[model samples]
Target: MFQIGRIIMPSPLLRRLLAALVLVTLALPSAAAADCYVHYKAKRTNPYGLHYGIIRVSGGCPSSPGGLVQSRISSGGWTILNVVKVTTSSPSSSERRSAGSHYYR
Candidate 1:
């Protein structure tokens, strides 16, 4: 038997359930910190071109993902124009098609 404030919790099963709930609560933040997807528009000038892309960013999504996206694609000489969206879900088939060669980069 355990007393929590004015409530009495008497069952061992209830204690186990409470313990599990606490553990899952503690785990929520780390789960939320998992990798995220960034959808963005970029441009490369020479011949002059534009593309839309979806990229997986590990360690979680930033409040502002533009700088990170620019850095990742800079090696290919692409400049990020704007972030279209950020989400935990992968891009849909239509989105992947739109991204074309830029998909998952």
Candidate 2:
């Protein structure tokens, strides 16, 4: 039998496999925990104003970025032009503030 931390395994082979599984499981979260940011363009009616902004995606998934962008932006009556790009990096705080309240929330 072999012991790893608090977990015990009955055989050496089982211990190695268990250790591998544990390592993989532990690594999954950091991979999944990555945050994605979407930079986009949008427009509002009436006076017809246009703006560019960046938003942090919650789920960090493929569909989540576009959905989040549309839901957040359109709720304020802005029509989405396009999602320029999705990235794991965020702009500086000052840059976000420059986009104003209507941008990233």
Candidate 3:
């Protein structure tokens, strides 16, 4: 039978390399990370006090750019405070959407 001695590796070097990789990744900005959009809804009423509009929850990831999962903007749940009224000069082009946007927890 043949046995090999225990081989040890430096921990500091590995840690440094990992840290560098993380820094590089974060430094490079992408089109991700929303910046507080809007969740414009019909609000059950309108500027003209009319109740003849549509109600929907589209996309609103600009209200809270930092909106994140397990925090504010999540997929499994919904936020009431983020709900708002959708406004458009063209009456035919108005619809509701989500307010806050986030990535993951």
Candidate 4:
């Protein structure tokens, strides 16, 4: 047991465990932020189609990773709507259900 200011504290082992937990929690954000998942809306002209999908962006991010998104979507002849969101995590297949085959396959 210990006392800090006027507050009583737990045993030294408990304090060390708490300190380790705090350090791990503090480190989580950087681990989570290490990857980039870009989500965007895109369209096609002739047949008139729209889609929302995700892509993994290499390097950091862009004001518009339009070129990155465009390259992937372009294979299907779709034009981009600029990156709507850049995230640190990728969407799970279950979460991508709405996007169907257009997902980050």
Against the reference, the lDDT scores of all candidates come to: 0.91, 0.77, 0.34, 0.78
lDDT by residue (1-105, candidate 2, tens digit) is 877898875897887999999999999988787877788788999778998888876546466466778888777788878878787777767757766765455
Model 2 misplaced regions, further than 4 Å: 1-21, 92-98
Residue pairs clashing, model 1: none
Task: Judge candidate 4 at residue 43 and give its lDDT.
Answer: 90
Number of the top-ranking candidate, with TM-score as the measure: 1
lDDT by residue (tens digit), candidate 1, 1-105: 888999987789888999999999999988888889999999999768899999998878898899989989999989999999999887899999999999889
Displacement of the residue 12 alpha carbon in candidate 2, Å: 8.5
Regarding TM-score, does 2 or 4 come out ahead?
2
Model 3 CA deviation exceeding 4 Å by range: 1-5, 20-35, 39-47, 50-105
TM-score of each: 0.78, 0.65, 0.21, 0.57
Clashes of each: 0, 0, 11, 0
* Cα lDDT, model 2, residue 81: 86
Candidate 4: Cα lDDT at 57: 61
lDDT of 4 by residue, 1-105 (tens): 888999998998998999999999998877655757788889999899888888776555665677878888888889997677777667877658866777773
Worst 10 residues of 4 by lDDT: 56-65
How accurate locally is residue 27 in candidate 2, as Cα lDDT from 0 to 100? 91
Query: Which runs in model 4 stand beyond 4 Å of their true positions?
Result: 1-33, 58-63, 92-94
Error of 4 at 87 (Å): 0.4
* Reference-based lDDT, residue 79, model 2: 81
